[model samples]
Target: MRYPIETLGEALAEGIVTGHPAMPQFELTPPEINDLLSYLKSLE
Candidate 1:
């Protein structure tokens, strides 16, 4: 479970200003978070 803390941090920061309704509020399990991070990192 290795999420890119930075990505979550950035999302939180951006959501603060944009007030995005899609922004998630709950904490994700380690595996789910890691999977998302892996997907995003691969896009780079």
Candidate 2:
């Protein structure tokens, strides 16, 4: 969460797929990303 919401949104929009074995590959819809960003920003 060190990154700004805009940067996080941009990254989320493209989807996230890590090579790490424990990480899950998935993409979030615009609304979902917005929800997540809201929750994250609440912590700030």
What are the C-alpha RMSDs, in order, of all predicted structures? Answer: 7.0, 2.1
lDDT by residue (tens digit), candidate 2, 1-44 = 25577699988899655658798878899999999999998987
Put down candidate 1 lDDT per residue, 1-44, tens digits, no spaces: 33355667455344434357685555556677667767777897
TM-score of 1: 0.44
Clashing pairs in 2: none
C-alpha RMSD between model 2 and the true structure: 2.1
TM-score of each: 0.44, 0.74
Candidate 1 lDDT trough over 10 residues, lowest sum: 9-18
**In model 1, what is the error at residue 6, expressed in angstroms?**
4.5
Local distance difference test values of all predictions, in order: 0.58, 0.83
**Residue pairs in clash, model 1:** none
Compute the lDDT for candidate 2: 0.83
